[model samples]
Target: MTTETTPKPQHPPLEPATEGQVLSGAEILVQSLMRAGVDVAFGYPGGAIMDTFHFLNRSPIEFILSRHEQGATHMADGYARVTGKAGVVIVTSGPGATNTITGIATANMDSVPLVVITGQVPTTMVGNDAFQEADVVGITRPISKHNYLINDVRDVARVVREAFHIATTGRPGPVVIDFPKDVQQAQTAFHWPESVDIRGYRPDRLEKKISPSHPMVQKAAKAIMRAKRPVLYVGGGAVIAGASEEVTALARRCQIPVTTTLTGLGAFPEDDPLSLQMLGMHGTEYANYAVDQCDTIIAVGARFDDRVTGKIAEFMPQCECVIHIDIDPSSISKNIQVDIPITGDAKACLAALLELVEPTERSEWAEQVLAWKKHHPLREEFGDDEIHPQRVISAIDEIAGPDKITVTDVGQHQMWACHFITHLRPRSWLSSGGLGTMGYGLPAAIGAKVAAPDRAVWCISGDGGIQMNMQEMTTAALNEIAVKVAVLNNQYLGMVRQWQQLFYGRNYSYTCLRRRSICEKVCRDPGSGKCQAYLPNIVAMAEACGWQAQRVERRAGIRDAIQWAEETPGPVLLEFSVHREDNVWPMIPAGQGVKKMMRGMELI
Candidate 1:
């Protein structure tokens, strides 16, 4: 499905400011958001943005006051990732705007749609280092999909519309609009444009695209016909384009196996026999082996990143030709050279391929892939005395069932969730995949809950990553959002500590959370000394934030705790005391190849 028919309900436009009537620029800005069909916004107010915040007092659009500007933007990002509408964020100047850069870049890197509105000093004082003023447009230019500095009040509607258009169209990404204080204070007549028209941007063609009967698509078909081992490498674009049905249909018709990237987790059904699950760094053993052995690989809406494609030359050595389909023309073949590149929407390109592609017998290839999967299953040694994080993830997956969403923070736990949990639908697995931003899970899960209140939203975060935005616990509690948060507390920054143990020798250094001043300065292998006390007491902090908190020390109680959280009315925090030294497996070290993937301490 395209954005035109995407399932995310576009909020109906609220009553706009009366036509041909004069209003303050701040009021006009608020009216513009209403007219643009923005039912919700996430932000924090400050000196520079007081006017807009003041006008928001009477607007019908709902606003979420975040604890920080970065958290606000991340909320918007999560809102956008699941809902088809562009997420909206409003923040004050200087530090507020700078804080949004991380969230904006996170969305940009993942191609998630968001429109960030930041307050700026008066146009006359743009470069004078005015109080709370920063070059927001300049700082965000390289990271954002597009950015604008509104100098005049009259340009507000046009710019906001264009920002949404650029953000939600082909190859979606975050767009920033720097609103000046003076412009917000200026009076102007409000008018909402019926459509957006921007030169040099023609993403409309993607929607207008017909089922590709072109030579390029036909060539891709021929490649599929010729290959005995063909794999469908799906990505976030497949999710963004709502092309799961098309991708699934195409894969099934040809009986080809599917392998996805982290961001592309739910693009194809993981339970399907054809699925190789994830296929890169921290990917499954069979998936990596499949890619290494396949003769043809078809990438949909996926950029062949270094994370997905390890040391390009060694990525798909057995693959004869590459077929890549994406909406962004520049992304096609920009990273990995494409033999048959189709630059269009994933749904459209794929729908067309289904018409021409012929079904062939791949039972032998499929059987081989299944044999590899059976041989190298994703499993962890769980001691009866210690909690296994993988079992916790699997428990959540089983208890939550299929009608839920799973979000994760970046860590060993994130990879564990990917390995153990199963997601059968798009927008169900939300994570900071491209940017790998920590502290994203909590606020993002809150935003996702706000978007789909009926579904159970589970947020899994590391002890370290959760603290980065744990302040949002108040945002969730005050709003009474039923988002279940699971903090896998291992007492150390697990991923980094693993790296320190692996490549940097056994120097634990400052990675230990329970380290005392009396401990060794470098804290060599401090993880060995298991401490009963976890610093900062996440349960106490969460309960203080008006949430139901439970701490589970035994692996046997994981399900009961999660069930208790699900039954609880408001936000719940379940902190599981897990093994500190567990590391993510099947990792391909940076600048290495798939051939160098390590399953444990040694290369497979």
Candidate 2:
């Protein structure tokens, strides 16, 4: 069959009318967003931002009115993570702006692209601490990739364009634009820049080709060829750069095993034999062992974060050579020294390495990794009686399918989801990876569903974490976003309690969400009859919000619960009554080395 596939035609970037009637700064701002191709934005309205909101009401851009600013930011983050586009957010001054800090930090940590616009007080009241005023640029300086406080109404179009450009470019992260109230009211001619030229802001520098003959690429290839055991450790950068195919090609071609960070989930298919689901704290035991044993480590788009490198000295002690590849030059050897540092896009560097490196059989190394995998497989069985959190996640994975997008809030459930769900596609797994923000799941799922309305979205949250932004349930219900929320109700702050149990001799200290003050510090088992009743019935709350809801306590009912949520007409909340005191295993205690991993009552 000799059939030619036509290439998809590319459309030119949308441009605003050059001689269009003069418009208010708010109108120009909306037009700027339209020009940048922003179809949806998550935000809240307040005095400073009222003008923009008024204009937004008439615009085609879909505005999602999140219950909280933090939730709105996460929604934008989730959208960006799934669509690879800069998610947009707009909020008013002071408290509204500060509320988004957590979300901004979360997005920054994960390298998710977001353009956050905050309405500011008038320029005259800049330092006067006017009503609802804030120094948003100052507050977000450290967290955002870049931030701006608009001084002139004419700068609106240019600033908006730059914000989007900065957000989506190399080493993507959130960019903040503070639009003053007076500027929004001021009149200006809207002239969207055809191209932005920011001096010293040359993200394009990272787009350069790394030829196969480049010395660094050649050196990386040689290092790979020389090592008998090489491990490909990837991170979120791989997902952001769309370098999954290149990463997999390099791993398979070189016969190297692959392990990814939590943010890097789905960068390489987890079902593959060479795939070591995740590495570092709460990572697979086999994966950690492989990293410890490998002679060569090729770190792609992964900065050696503290979570990933428990104790740097003890991490990869056997590794004699390191090849680091990332778009950000500073990220290379920032944490761990690298023998070969290639500063360029992940895909480009991997492609270059693929060309120079000759494929060789490393059967012995592969066998050793497989042996480790066999010896210490992930604990998936918790008997058939009670429902385990892992089983809940597994059931969801089965029902939702690999193609579905899964979002998670921070806690035991998040780790369990990472451990169990086999994410087959990049960006399908969304979580507050860097910041570990609680209450991010529901809103993020809303954003993900909004971004890809056709794809099924599942949100996995824990009892405590879900409560942080549970109010967003109304937002989801009102929008008719069919996001299936699985609350793993363990009746305790699982992660904190686990730490307390392991380190503080089970003091339990305030970790019990259900405990009353009169209860003992070391409370009785939640399953025991002595324990108090679980409060604020989650199922009842969901139903109150006009959502289809269910509560499941038995393992036999997991599938049916998940299926019900999937088939429900609108947003559904499934509360899985998980076992209390259950902990995420294969955990490296904080400040300890990866080698000192605790797995189900045994330290490896």
Candidate 3:
């Protein structure tokens, strides 16, 4: 019956009103954000939210105007993923609020903290279907960690404080604050609370109670000691909790071979000897094998996702003990049952476990993982005549180095980037892991660039995904935020086409991007020479948006193109014509186990 939330921010809340000072709700909201330490926000303006936007003009908080409402939310998501503080977004009601659904869902799924301020119709027009009014609270309730509707302008300061607190704490996710147009215009005696007090929620108890001597920590430590082959499965929670140091300490203390989920990439450095890299579907062969053969699994801040776990019955067939430590109490055993379930903040729990456990060696386990890694190394064994997708990604990874930020869209390219790129720090690798949204890369990259302008930011997206937020290039260009984008153009929707080719006997239906009405009826073959025409030139699109653009088709052009983009300033795009049918290797088919992993075309 216990529930725990994310750790509250260390930043102290603003002092309560020394004396009553009247202010509009719009100004109150902006002041609340400034006190919450929000330096930047992203949004598009509209009628319902225009008053707040006007107040924002005078506030010190930096705002980036996005082309689309959806893109604005996604940009906030991207900004939140990398930064310590919750990202802020402001948009008008109805379609503006609804447009943010996908991005909200994306943040919800991944546990990214974001405060989205949505405008609503006049209070008197509630349920009357006034212009640009929609039930935002009702629509977003399911996706957001929490949501609120300001009934009175007097509650603006309190609601904004609560929204940021709830969004950043206890399984961090987006929070929607629906402010009516009337409320924005109304006057209030602005007063910020000294502290947030939610009656039913008490994560402080969990934080204060969990120590090295806690029963669950002791139990997990015992479990770790007994197992001859232990594996540390790290995930995004570690990143959110800033527990990478703790995670690394525990892994090295036990010398347990570490494997990360896609979102868990940077928790343990891939270059480390104990690291098995990413596991599950589209994971490294060694990491999956390590999970399958290990006797113990100590999952840290990671849920047993279907993407990571495959078939529930068949996953971890040899594992004898399961130790799960997460900040969210509900997530502990939701997917897979665990013997030792420690629920608290990841940094706290991992630190406690680190103190309880002693150093140990598992040479046999290490050798087994090494053998698996060498047997099927992460690479592309394809002909050099064509520009393979892996080549473009790997070239970029090498050029970008280990410290730069790398964001990816979903599909084969996402999996390829996961396999090829090396992320040495938490929050360095960003992707829509849970939602698998296609258009996430570009806007998210802009957000990251805004958060960390000094660092190099790269968006490795598919041709299809880039187009979804391609218009954001104008936002990046006008702002002069330099974000390098590489489009892996495989002609067809690579992942879907790979599936159709694999399970459906090559009956490629509607996956092709270049399929014209004339080619749709007769063209069934993948990589058909007859269909030479490609639409919506990616380079031209980038150029039109005031970005430095290039097109690379040959193998040699991969490095040069990526290098050029890196060297160039402002926003840049590199479109690579990759092999159309090259599928991501080491893929675990849906509803299957690691035994059924497809490296080339067949299950291993």
TM-score of each: 0.96, 0.95, 0.96
Q: Which regions of candidate 1 are displaced past 4 Å?
A: 1-15, 206-210, 381-383, 530-533, 602-604
Model 3, 1-604: lDDT tens digits are 9789898855343332333578888878888888788899999889999988877866777899999988898899989988967989999999999999999999999999999999999899989988888999999999999899999999998998888888888789999999999999999788988799999777777777789899989999999988998999999998988999988888888988889988888988888888888999888888888899889999988999999999999999999999998888899789898989998898999888888888888788878878888887987767467898888888888988877999998899999999888768999988999999999999999999999999999999998898888888999999999999999998788889889888988877878888888876645666667775898898998999998999997887888888888899899999998888888887889989987888786442
Candidate 3, residue 415: Cα displacement in angstroms equals 0.2
How many clashing pairs in candidate 2? Answer: 0
lDDT of 1 by residue, 271-303 (tens): 998889998888998999999999999999999
Worst 10 residues of 3 by lDDT: 11-20
Angstrom error of the Cα, residue 146, model 2: value is 0.6
**Per the 3 Å backbone cut-off, how many clashing residue pairs does candidate 3 have?**
3
Which residue pairs in candidate 3 have backbone atoms (N, alpha carbon, C) closer than 3 angstroms, thus clashing? 5-170, 6-169, 6-170
Candidate 3 segments exceeding 4 Å error: 1-19, 602-604
